[model samples]
Target chain A: MTKPLSTEVDALSARHPGVIDRPLTQRFLPFAVAFVLIAYVFGSLASFDVVRVLSGTRTDLVNLFFLDSYAYKVHAVRKLESPEFVLSLEGSRYAVYDERPAWLAVTGEETDIDLGSDGRVHIKGDTLEYYPKDEEVAYKIKFGPGLVPQLVEGVAPDWMRASDIQVDMRPSLFARIWITKSKIEIHRYFLGWENFWFDFDSPLNGKSFGEIASLAVSGERMDPAMANWQYIFFQFWNNQEWQHGEVYYALLQTVIMALVGTLVAGIIALPLAFAAAANINPVGVARFGIRRFFDFLRGIDTLIWSLIFIRAFGLGPLSGIFAIFFTDTGALGKLFSEAIENADRKQAEGIQATGASSIQKYRFGIFPQIMPVFISQLLYYMESNTRSATVIGALGAGGIGLKLLETMRTRQDWENTAYIIALIILVVIIMDNMSGWLRRKLIEGSN
Target chain B: MSAQVTLTQNPRLREIGDAYERLSRSRSLYTVLLIVVCAVIIIGGFMVADEANSGSFWGGLSSFFDYPADIITGTYAAGWGWFALVWSYLPFLVETINIAVLSTIIGFALGALLSFVASRNLVRNKLIVFCMRRVMDICRAFPELVIALVLVLSLGPTPLAAVIAVAFHTIGALAKLFSEVNENADMKPVDGLKSVGATWGQQMRFGVLPQVLPNFLSYGLLRLEINVRASAILGFVGAGGLGAELKKVVDWNYAADISAIIVLLVAAVIGIDYLSGWARRALIGKTGTI
Candidate 1:
């Protein structure tokens, strides 16, 4: 009484026809896609030469980026001919210290360093000695002929690396000492950003937080003709090393660029969207032309637009705003037209029955229906354009992004780059949260 | 009809009418205030930007077409050589597309895994879901150029930097979107698989993935379109692609070359957009414009 499974399926397929006899293409489509994807992946891997890049990358630069971002190095440089030691951040003369810092003790020809658990470093004349905490022996680097520092005593520790010209002794992850006959440089690393609150030129540079707070509030004035708090505020805002005021202004400019760009784009697109909408435009040729125009606008990359604008407008946020506006108008126009096309026509018909003019009907019926979409889309673009503006700004339009590029170009200002990056992330996150919240409120209100 | 007429004439009706009028007046007042505030902000913002700019808007408007005009003339003069210029840029265009495609694939794979952990209903651990979401948010907050610029310094103008930058962004973006799709997936199959003693991974693989795969593919395709644009822009920062070529030409002030490169970029972008759009519709089994 039981038929074989294949014969029984055949019998069923004979009855149902197309239901059981699926096309070969239908069954093989997924496999075909998978095959193409896998082949492309392999082909790209070979063509991109990913292995060479991975091997060729300067790994130390990557490591330095992480180390340099949050921490700063204070270098104590002593010329071979002079006993006078110069202490400065990153060996920059502009940031030199007028008074001795607490970490180093100089007593005549000898000096002592408190390197924490890595033990003490004793510098006497041309000899640098690193005394390990557990070992009785000390590693000594002697500055010999031609100012070349050579390891002269004891087994060299793993942390100390020597070359023909200099010896680099890294006591800890953050601390390093470089010695040559020409100069002896001690780089002490500290956590947290230096000169963030006040640069070295400020009178309040080495003051404690409580002291600074008191200076801000108390009757004692740091400068004449200004209140103590005002002077403190001015000092902090205009800190030469940080440029906080300019950065904040640039950030504001970037945000304003996004806001203006989106708002103007939306304002212009709402009308053009009508011209492209199927129900409203009706005329096939005109609608097609408008639609293709939108595509043309959208097709040209914002980078190209900003570059062109930069040429005409010189270098500034105006170019950035124009670029964002031009690109977003095309995008918003397309979306708005789609929303218009999908809008329910029954309300418009009702308005027509009330003897309303076409414009009045669009305003009373269609506009209200699409208001939520328009608002939400504008807000969304505003957030995204904030990001785009940053990029455009990096491409020469003036903003925080331009400042970021400037710092990055310095090669040694990695800390400043990190600071700008952190600020960018903070502002972007804030915009995202604000846009989401506003979108919810606006959508609910529209309904 | 008599009752309706009496109701309209009642004191209570008048009170209701008065309240309604007050509400409507306040509402209209708010609307007008909002419109005025928006107008002022836009205008004020524009003025501030204009002041900060090197060239005034009105001053620049007259010269706006000067650059374009020059580019057009140059391109016209190049004649058939323009085709060669565009053709020469194809390899860089291919490099740009490769970065987008590879990053998309890698990001999709990583994002699929992260999305599972990030999904609230799928993952029972509240801390994991919270942490993963924040991680994704942080990753997404970073612009690709920021990462690419940093990497270019270390990697020396290689496409690998752009790839990693775009991939990092794609992972975060796709994870967020994929988790949203996961949230909408039917829970019954997962429950059924669990009751049959399936492990979490197996359950997710058999139950949840099948439900959300089509949408995942659709979003992945859409992300590919975005990444193409992103990678091209990343190339401008010395990450090596079509943008690098564009930047080179721009820096040299090669008008015809710039025009040709722009043409190629536009064509590639629009072509990819169409291809991805078509693929997405096919994958999702939907016809109307998104």
Candidate 2:
């Protein structure tokens, strides 16, 4: 054994030069130029205007806190007049105001009245407040499109009454990307294109049904009046940088969560993984039980795990983290255990034959042999888990997935959705390159 | 000195002593940990499970009593807790199996092609291998759910989208596996092919693929089993399958169906495990190989 080891060392050294002598000019020069070109291009494209990106990101955070909806648009924002804005659409009526002290109450609360008997309507006290000192106070107005003459019937400030009732084209600049919403609806008060007494009436309209059977028969394309994708992209792209920047943040969050989950998984699983290896245990029962346990945990989708944990733990980063861990531990554990089991048993035997304890044998022999494989697995899982995190996050466990869902539901922000997803992909690409480089380093000699 | 001499002379006594010592030292800890894990999984799962709403545990057990009849008749109304009995639509359900098998086959076929180019041993062009491997990595790096979501949104959520999503993921997974297997194959045949002035294609066809078939089939079949379970959930995204029904049941607060679906899924998995084991053993027998 001692003679063989010395001879193996001599042979390896004789076959391969100790120093790397590949011509840098031939092998690396092109890569250098390509790297620079890519970096420059990405930097330029990503920055577009450095000043604007920086300012926009900062401006967005400020606007977001105040619940400002006009983050991107500057010209002709649909501002409420005199602190009160009232509108009636689709047989529904509501009043809106700036996010100020005085609050407005737009209610769909119903009160049945015998119209013929009531000569005059009795009003309740303080139905609406234009500018209440506290958030607790809100203005109350009684208005319905069902009453042909009026959709909004209340005494507001004279200037407010005269002001145009229009929705702000700009949602708040500081709007929370996932949660904040800006809605604009054209009410069908008087009815159609040829209809209505005032601006309260919408020129365009659509129908709805109470039941699914009735709905399918209505012959309405589910996403009727679907906007062009290019048009949607352009519209959102023009919005202030900071507001749109939240979408990137959301995407960043998705990638970060994925990485964190993967890291946490590797950190916790490494020790257990060592024990789980078949060679370490050698006992069939021990190996079978551990392997099966790992399988059960990793067998399901991260989303399913997320769903299970979400149900049990409720939605948040915590739930997502646990879900990621629960699955990743199983997966990484399997990979690591297999790697350990596959490592040259001779190395461990050599250490053990020296009368070393199991721990000592593992540390000196198995650990060194399997360390590279473990690192490779960890790197791959990190890249892989990033994709997983996005899906798992969609389980409402709080990450980019939540943001995407909210954006789609509220604004149908396809552009932002695209941006968020694009960012996740970018992060993954970077990780892929890094992992590839590492794997090359690890496997160079063996290959 | 006397004890050492006796131990050396009689190997049996020393072996028995070592076995006893190893067992006495480690057995208790392992048994305890295992028993604790089993207890938590078996008991805690039930304790936390929404069995009360799902029909009583006993009620769930009893429903399986009439599973065959119930599977056909059961819909939104006549659901059994333990037996999802979607067995009546076994044809539609088998379609899920078909999708799983077909997608796995298709994914790995394409992946195998890519893997041939990606393997370092086969391809001396570092750039090509890097690109191909990166492509596979990216493809597989994505979880099926994300792919499903993307495909659903773009393609208007068809079963075809689900199939494509599953296939792409399979490509990613199987490509990497195939590449690794390719790297590990015996080089003798490849060397022989090369000596005969065989083209790279001929070398792969005649030299390489035959040796790797069992490994590829094993991995592909294993993926198929995984995909069957995965595709089952694809329905949650409006893709076709039993998972769609599973989602519907969950949405409608049908606890019984949830339990029934889980049970069915577990059973399906066990069945696949048995089938995979048999196949692997048969292949091993033929090849005298792993």
Candidate 3:
């Protein structure tokens, strides 16, 4: 049997010579030409500087952003009139010092910043000094009354950088000191986001989990009226830096926008889908017109719709929801009509035989068959639209997306941006799982 | 014997009828409750949204057609000048399409790699599959605009940023789909290859890939359609594309220019949809009903 099959295959190959016999050039030449053409087009049209991007020219910027996202800066500024140093995170008033970190010390007229192994930056009166761990000589800078900072002549080392208005010295990678006419400053770089849960002014700012747990169990109220746990919760909820409450509300708004948009779109699309369905409508022109109208709506895209709606509704969740609703109605209409056309006709015929009106036939017979498909599609769209709502929100529609964009625009608060991103990911994952579960349940349940 | 049969039959039939009636009554009650809840939620949500909006829904309802009318009138006033305006913005449109195409290609490549590793049928290690799946999930979770905005900060407002952002999302989406396709694929050829001592790569390339490529291509084309729209939106947030140009025109309140650009975008999207729809049907052999 195998021998005969092999012989038959060979005979068939023999009959179709071109199909079986391919020259090496014939096989590979087209691919080569296509590759060359793609390369040519990319080079000319994109004008992408492949070498520049690959050669690590932009690594510094990338590194700066990456480091900035995780690590925060400790800024200690001492003004000429003020003896005490003002400590802050990212120079934000919200994160200003209630008390300095353990490594920082401010006494009478002197401030000492111990930057771990990177050594120390000390400011005494009008003079600033950076003491490197590896080196014996300290880089010294003295500020004068003439609004100029002068590095002490022979004490200035190779790491010390001086300018007319400021004297800057880097004792190490982790520590820096700047002496200017108006103020003396030291900056210490540390890893990890600081004050994410609670700001400096909060009583619960630097408590460990164990400490917080103990506080929750037995400690006195931080505020006179509230319990210890309540105080902590309030502090974190109203956190000036992170604003967890506002973020949560924005997230809720985003989800609500998606839900409202998807549900409304589904509702609107049902009738429109029936109108577009060939068997239901029967009229070719009307069906054609309705289908083209859907195509137009879908082709307009959500961004353009949002832009147009913003003109009417102005900036809010309504515009975003409407944008999502309008675009998704078209998509859902197209999907739903196809499902309608594919529905089992015998059920509808049975209903029609019972002397039922057309509406009754559709309601009792047609809807039951396609309901599962419609629901599953709607759930899927809800999940996807949650993401789209974020994008729409960025265009001033309203939601966490607007917040994310606003945070991004600040170009500071990268940690907050990171937080927002994490929240979005969390929400999206939850929605994804929820939708998948619902789809499985609904579709499978119908069967 | 007749009296006993009548006595049993009457109670049994009555009980069955009562149970059926009870079940249906409860079911209808639940349905009514569900409908009521849905109606309340929808009405409440609409009210809240209306309140949040700058203009009331009723107030804005009348003026809903005003912007479209303005755009139409402005285009008509241009009297073929709209064509010139669209032509001038063609380069920007091309940039948008380039963003979509490049991102889709990059996404397809990454998604292919990820899908193979993530596929439970393909990968030997459960941990690797789990890790790859989560990575894809995280990638998919991020909105392209969010990623683009972040990238713009580090890379400036360049097309590359949009490409990376869009491609990142595409990888996640396509990987999930591709892995689903892989799961449904026939495993006999893979088993045959394995019996012959074929390597994993060889089995995948020769056995599985042939089965899944057409589906993957179809899905990829669909993704390309989505990415084009996404890339256009990314431009609104400062990533270079037709969206950015549209935003600029909108800011200047050049109604004709806005309408012209919108028309061109619609045309491009519709054209791509038709072309890709045709290609998909051709590749997939028109398997679906209707």
Candidate 4:
């Protein structure tokens, strides 16, 4: 009886394999194959040697960027004529300091630099000695004839490098020292942006918040021509290193470009949108032509438009504005026409029933329905266009973007780049928030 | 006598009519004022831009079509050679699209993660939401070209630089949009999963993801379209791609080449736009309509 039942079960299974009953491999094989094929294709196309690239990648540039962004190098150069030190940030002449940090001791004969537990570098006329904090042995570097830097044989360590014309000694992680043909220099790395507010030449340099507040209110005028507060304001505003004034102007130009472009585009697009809208424009060919015209304008990207406009207008904010206007006109025309086409016909018909003219029908009946969408989209474009204007400015259409690219090209001006980046970010965020707020207010208020 | 009686007795109706007229009058005045303000701003801005421009608007108007005419004639002169020129730059165009695709993929992955953290309805942690939102804002705030230029300076001019720069921006953009989508998701499914003792990730996967996937995919497609345009633009700033090639041709004054490259670029843009639109519609199941 059991043998017969088992054979029956086998017969039933073989005869009636259900539709849902399939082998797992059979079900998933196509997907698995597709997955593998896609992976293979991407792998071959990207040619990504992940492990090699990751391993071979150097952090030197990133380290430099980070170090340059927040930390600044203070250079104390030993003068040849006198034993005095000319201290400056990045060796800029405008940042020359009459005083020195507490860690630096400049005497008539010897200059001592404290590297804060790393080591001490002592310069005595024609000889220099670097004493590692943990070691007793001091590496002595001698200035040979013609002021060439020379290190004693077998005494130079791995951290300290020496050559005929220059000697670089890394006494600590935070500090470095160099001796060249003309001058001995010590670089002390400090955290935070150097001279962001007041330069070394300013009287307000190194002043605490409370001290600055007091000085602003009660202190004597730092400059004869101006009050203390006025002097501070002017100093910061006209800071030669940062050029905050020029930056502000560039920012203004960017905002203006975006605003003008967006508004003008909206104004131009409104009429063209009607021409593209099928319900508004009865002629099919005309509507098709206008739609394709918009598409052609849009198909040509803003970068191309800007490039062409730059040639015509000869590079300024105007070219950027025009580029934005032309491109946005295409986009806005399409968007606005869609909005118009989607509008309820009842109101328009009702206006027409009341013996209203076409313009009046649109203005009173159609405009109210699409106003919220139009305003919201216009605001959105204005915000995004602000960013686009920056990119256009990089192509020599004038804006903060030009300054940013220019500063970045100068390479060592990373701090200025950081400042400009910060300002741009702030402006963009403000614009974003402002547009959002305005959109909500206008839409809700109209409702 | 009947007209006098109706007029005197319906004083409330007359008052309402008077009030309506005054309101309409004030509204029309405001409208006129707004129009005037807009006109003034447009005119003033135009004047300022004209003054700041290197060439006057009137002078540029005459030569507005000069460059395009030159390009057309040049391309016409080249005849079938323009096609060959376009074909030659195809690889760079592919590189441009690849940069866009790679950036969009990376950006979508990272942005989705960030969006979950940034979404007010999803994340309970206030500080994480604040910090993540601000980080996205900063990322979005940076222009892709600026970042690309900086990266090129540090990392050398390479496609990788463009990819990274565009990716950074995409992350911010997609995160903001994704979070907005997440905000609108129904919470009942999430609550049901939570009642079943599902973990946070499980709840999100089994509940929210299913609901938001279509919208997310739609947004991602739109971002891809945008990223392609951005990557192309970024190439102009020395991050190597078709844009760099175009810049070279432009610098060398190759009018035929410029036209050919532009046609190719326009074609690529329009193709991507259509593909993305179709994909978005399919994902959202909103077919047969614009």
Best by DockQ: 1
Candidate 3 stretches greater than 4 Å from native: A1-26, A29-41, A48-64, A80-83, A92-101, A106-111, A122-129, A133-160, A170-174, A202-234, A351-357, B1-37
Model 3 alpha-carbon miss at residue B206, Å = 1.0
Candidate 1's fnat? 0.70
Candidate 2 per-residue C-alpha lDDT over A292-320 given as tens digits, one digit per residue, 9 for 90 to 100: 88777766546456656555455554556
Instruction: Tell me the tens digit of each residue's lDDT in model 4 across B1-290.
Output: 98656755798877777798898898788779978977877788778778878998889988888888888898899998788898999998988888888888878878988888899998899999999999988888888877788677666667777888999999999999989989999999999999989999998888898888788878888888888888888888888788999889999989999998898889999899889988887887754223
Docking quality (DockQ) of candidate 2: 0.03
In model 4, the runs with Cα more than 4 Å from the true position are A1-58, A79-82, A117-119, A132-138, A144-157, A198-234, B1-37, B287-290
Q: Positional deviation of A43 in candidate 3, in angstroms?
A: 3.3
TM-score of chain A of each: 0.91, 0.45, 0.83, 0.84
For each of the candidates, the C-alpha root-mean-square deviation to the true structure, in angstroms, is: 3.2, 21.6, 4.1, 4.8
Q: Which CAPRI quality tier does the interface of model 1 achieve?
A: medium
DockQ for all models, in order? 0.73, 0.03, 0.53, 0.49
Candidate 3 steric clashes: 0
How much native contact recovery, as a fraction, does model 2 achieve? 0.03
Native contact fraction per model: 0.70, 0.03, 0.55, 0.52
Model 4 Cα shift for residue A312 (angstroms)? 0.6
lDDT of 2 at A80: 15
Q: Is model 3 an incorrect, acceptable, medium or high docking prediction? A: medium
Error of 1 at B192 (Å): 2.8
